[model samples]
Target: MTRMIDIIVPVYGGYEESLRCLQSVVSNPQQTPYRLLIINDASPDPRIHEDLRQFAARHDHVELLENKENLGFVATVNRGMAFSEDNDVVLLNSDTEVANDWLDRLVAAAGRDERIGTLTPFSNNATICSFPRFCQSSAMPDQWDVASLDALFSRVNVGEVVDLPTGVGFCQYIRRVCLRETGLFDVERFGRGYGEENDFCRRAARLGWRNVLCCDVFVFHEGGVSFSHEQAERIAQSQEVLQQLHPDYHALVEKHIQQDPARLQRTRVLLEMLRTSPRKKVLHLTHHLGGGTKKHIRELSVWLTGGMDALVIRPVEGGGAMLSFGATDSAPGLFFSLPQMYPQLLELLRAAGVSRLHFHHTLGLETCLWGLPHDLQLPFDVTLHDYYFINAHPSQTDTKGRYTPDLDAQSSSYPLTVSLEEWQDNQRQLLQKAQRVIAPSAWAVREFQRYYPGLNYLVAWHPDSEKQMPWPAVENPYRGERPLRVLVLGALSPEKGADILESVAVAAHKESAPLEFHLLGYAYRPLADAVIEHGAYSEADLPRHLQELQPDLVWFTAQWPETYSYTLSEMLLAGLPIVAPDIGAFPERVRHRPLTWIEPWDSSPEQWLRWFREIRDFLAQQNRHARPWQDQPVPRGAEGFYRDSYLSEMESAGEKELPAVDDAWLGSLLLQSRQAEGRQGRLSRKERLLMHLLMLRQGRVGRLVSRLVPVNVQRKLKRKLSRKPIHELHRK
Candidate 1:
């Protein structure tokens, strides 16, 4: 008995392609008997849906199954193959144009071989000379010659056995019997699209079924049969169907591409730091239009050269991670992200003569670090822009009201970093391949080092210049005869201590020298039921809001450990004395920089009121002592601090002694130390001079080596070692 091939073609959008594919199939010259199963994957575009109805309404042998709603490709095919009933189903791509004798040749191949339980008409993905490509219309190269495939791709062979690797999508004629033996495509996987047919073919073989390619009846696949760009959307509508249609294939695809190629690419291409370069390279990974963190390089560049106009960021095209983030609820693994993108970044760097990579991110590093490509692993430097540990849970507020990770089952709808073990695991993996670690605050460096020792931690403190605006040396913006304006900025949260301040607002104002409090940003949105919303301020608008609010002091006010407070740096740069809680990095950055540290009350409202009252008085007196204060120069000049610190931090290895960093990242460690020094500080001239000279090595390695030549090398070593150590700028 001769077997018939029932071809299932999913029709949705691209009506033009569908009609052309239909004409190729039904009009075959081979006169092979077959049924055309057209699955209308209820497309969003009604025009295409209507066209499908009209076309199917006319064909006799063509059976139409219009899905009530779009049920993706696999589902539609499962239904199409069901309607196909009793015949072999060839799941075909509508984008493909068929050959005249495709069905007859496939039917003949199956008729001749009882063991052939699966079959496909071959098509290659790389479209070399398939179509006319402005090739001067010379003697055109012949399209695919089946003889070539037989010679080159003949992989399977045995006595009376014709074996071949899995087929590419064009026309796959699946044996209905094979379904009973191997079962249907796994409905759980959302991994495959182009590779689905190959997966099916392999599974059938594993179940002792054989496949044959009827090359004699070759199809001139106008190509991209099952999945064109638009068809993919239709495919998503029925991932469930595809899961049932093709199982393990989905797993392979997800493992390889993560449903998004960009993620896979970014994870693959992260480069290592250049060991030979003058300056260490770090790959900065930004997930989105990051607000406060992404512009770090731009600010640092300007601060490094003394003027914004002198140093500018020039983006290298098609470099860095293969994956670029849009917006995502969860972390896409490193295998699918930055690790994959290193090669491209390295290529771009090599072309531009860049030697190292600097990696930065506002989100946690674990996602990208965990899934990086093993073969392509590169030495890298990292600057963590934010910590998940900052602030307290919303339902569970700390003193301030920031949303800490909700650890309770009810609060943690999504998985969050739960414990020190998980955090350390991720942190250790992040620093596993790093040449050096760079952070903006002392507290960040210290806290990370607490669990992860043996690694070099470079403290590139955040600069005090972030919030500085161009202006003449002028009078204070908020000083007045009115009650001193006290400003508290940050999102509404316990860690931010906004609620605590609100609790004290009325009491602080009741004193004889009452203080006027102004709370800003998201932190005040809800708790300060009395707060005035500043609308939505982008980073650009934040400074303007500060100027208009005219507060005596801008409080950083974070209750958790901060890596380096961008806001703290901005506050110091503004030349307004700060009043912030001594937690995280805030205490170290603002300790000696003309700022008053205010510890939160242990529990008593009285101690809290006293602290608030004292701060109010201090602001009032500072304003009273205004004329000379306004005219006075900044205590230690602010502008050159970044440049001086950068030069100093990278000047010497003696500055840091972390056992973690070996000789490999000494240069990166120094550079990061200088940058950390630059990130948060008001450096004294004497301290700045010593730091610069220590970190700033003169001339080439050979030249300095020649200069270090001494009459008594041992005495010289002792003398160099005896130099007074530079105290931790603010070690408290």
Candidate 2:
């Protein structure tokens, strides 16, 4: 039996996109018999009407339909469906372009299983059916045309499909049998667009039919070209109708998002694309601890321009590693269990055609990962963010969190499963394989070479993404009339001088000195009552919080030698008068600035107070106390240099053409992580409510509701419902 499909494209606006869509439809070759049914639903554009007539005259397979008046999208699509005679129907948008055998693949997928009612193809902008990232719009990869992408999908994703709660309508194919049973789209409820296809899919699903994503086909959807102006309003209205008819619609979609059954298929196609492309991809291996190291990788990924892409493999819970393209919500991380799946991980990396390896830190990673460069035979680089290479503890601090200069004594007292020498040997072996050893500061280079001599290192200053602006001159209320206000930034772990901050706060309070202290970040434990903790803050919001506080002096009490500090860079941008210990990068970073003061690293809390008092007295004597702060120049533009440093001409381990290995285990592990059923069960009552609120906020109606609600009230509700942020809840 010959299968036929009627491709119904409802054209209303967007002249150029409509022309291209029809041209592509007519030009593309299809294995199955199909007719192009172009509908001009009372379009205001006369050029489109003439073009449609020309298309109908030029091609016998093409048929044209016209609406005497503006009947909207639901009526237009129903008219086309009514014109079809017992044939499967495809509701393609006017802004979509088709490629080689796209219709053939959709028809093939529909015929594969008898119960499959509707199917949507992979697209660049088709919501749940979108590629590169599901449920998000993705741009076409550089240097690739629509035909090339479609061909790649056809080749790589042959016979691949995933179940979808609802079929996306950008290029949806509906079976003739299923269409008859579910009936045409609800014209009365959804006269224009948006929720019509979802309603049809839901109705079909209730009648024991399945909606699927046809992964092998790729279409280009230039979305929102038709009815772009009224999109938000129409979408909001459509959501209300959907909720009323199918109360479980949101839940079904949310469940699909949680499970993410299409992840493996998407990953496979993406890896294949990257593998074949000429673009250079560098894999960065880092720890789970979110700090400067993670921040560095993220910035580097964003900064690297031209022929370069950065992927990350970071340690996760359960001793596994998650390979992620970038630090973004759309870019999902693929998990692979460590030690047990080390071989699989290696094969996966090679298959992706990773050009080089970059190790940022190894705190929580498996010891076996130390030999990755050697095992994979790939040139690599190692950036020394801390002293993990020299000591088991990255900070190299004593019990009191003070810098322990005596290496021999510290090494002797170090607690480890292996001897200090053995541990250092392992690190030495890893460093030896690196094509380049990177240090962010000159101080870091000097300190690192003290332990690992004769190793060449590259000094690249970390780039600051935050652009600086001059701060308005505000008279420090406490400068001359009251106690001088001091501020400390960042999370103060023991090695970061938490104890010192506590002691200084207590000393200032006990003596009733003309000084006050505030911490923008939390300490390791609760500090003295005198120290005011402002809790934690994100880097993006740091400047706003700092401006609000208007501290007379910014203080850093780090007890260890810092390699490079991102927070220090932020402070530099703020251009506030600074006080820090004379150790690590602080002295070099803050050198030659008149308003900056450096205290001895080993200075006692009382001595630190005296230094603060001296600064207070000096400011009091100054002719002008309040002046507009200017941004201090910081080193930037290392993106190109870093890109060159990481990129290599040497062939990757994958270039040797290793035999294919079954990646089923990796897929299974990834699926297990995404489908962790206990996630919802562990949520508290408040968290459950917060989760539902998050769902509502993410839905179409959410945007409308946000506009209706007062901004401050919405914020308060968010704060109360989300005591713990949504991201943290997801992690749990």
Best candidate per TM-score, number?
2
TM-score of every model versus the real structure? 0.39, 0.72
lDDT of candidate 1 over 79-135, digit per residue (tens): 777774578777777866665455665666666676777665534321211111110
lDDT of 2 by residue, 528-628 (tens): 77998899998789878987887877888899988878887777667677778887878766655647778898898888988888888887766555555
Full-model lDDT for every candidate = 0.48, 0.78
| Pairs in clash, predicted candidate 2 | none
> Residue 4, candidate 1: how far off, in angstroms?
69
Which window of ten consecutive residues has the lowest lDDT sum in model 2? Answer: 465-474
lDDT score, residue 523, model 2?
A: 70
lDDT of 1: 0.48
- Displacement of the residue 623 alpha carbon in candidate 2, Å: 8.3
What is the alpha-carbon lDDT for the whole of candidate 2? 0.78
**Which runs in model 1 stand beyond 4 Å of their true positions?**
1-282, 286-291, 301-354, 361-377, 384-423, 463-481, 506-513, 538-547, 601-606, 618-732
